[model samples]
Target: MERDKGKLELIATQRVNANSEMYKVVDFLNKSLKNYHLMFGLTKKDESMVISIYEVE
Candidate 1:
């Protein structure tokens, strides 16, 4: 995760077959932190999954 000013970027890697709980967590955090959470992408490579997120004021 990286933070700059009022923006935050998060890159989370997991198993491709695993449940994607990040979506819910992101939603919760957005409300909790009073910030907007934008989903960048979800990429899959072999057995690995990548979740990209951005939080902005």
Candidate 2:
């Protein structure tokens, strides 16, 4: 499998609410890992809360 090196790529996702403990963890990871090239995002779509981890550019 070959993939671009610097492209924004999704690493993982979870169907969990942003108000849950999962969000806090993700937020912590973001704060702790922002300088390490990872980005965390939380969103609500279609009546569900979604969290995503990405390898940022």
Candidate 3:
């Protein structure tokens, strides 16, 4: 941990276009990864969906 917090390291990222159902996938991944000290994040960039995976420890 850095500064008393677990450092988040980016493991993967992808940008998908024309997919409206991607939130469901991110939700599922978040649920599944919670117990493993991992996180799934999503962002809206222009017309694309940006997804990322981070390790919490």
Best by TM-score: 3
Separately for all candidates shown, the number of backbone clashes (residues 3 or more apart, or on different chains) is: 0, 0, 0
Q: Write the per-residue lDDT of candidate 3 for residues 1-57, one digit (tens) a residue.
A: 345367788999988894778889889988987889899989988889889999887
- Residue pairs whose backbone atoms clash in candidate 2: none
Ranked candidates (TM-score, high to low):
3, 2, 1
Candidate order by decreasing lDDT: 3, 2, 1
Show model 3 residue runs off by greater than 4 Å: 1-3
lDDT at position 23, candidate 2 = 68
> How does model 3 fare in lDDT?
0.86
Instruction: State every prediction's TM-score relative to the real structure.
Output: 0.32, 0.61, 0.75
Q: Which TM-score value belongs to model 3?
A: 0.75
lDDT of 2 by residue, 28-53 (tens): 98999988899988887765788888
The C-alpha stretches of model 1 lying farther than 4 A from their native spots are 1-18, 35-57
**Higher-lDDT candidate of 1 and 3:** 3
Report residue 2 deviation for candidate 2 (angstroms).
14
Q: What TM-score does candidate 1 reach?
A: 0.32
Best by lDDT: 3
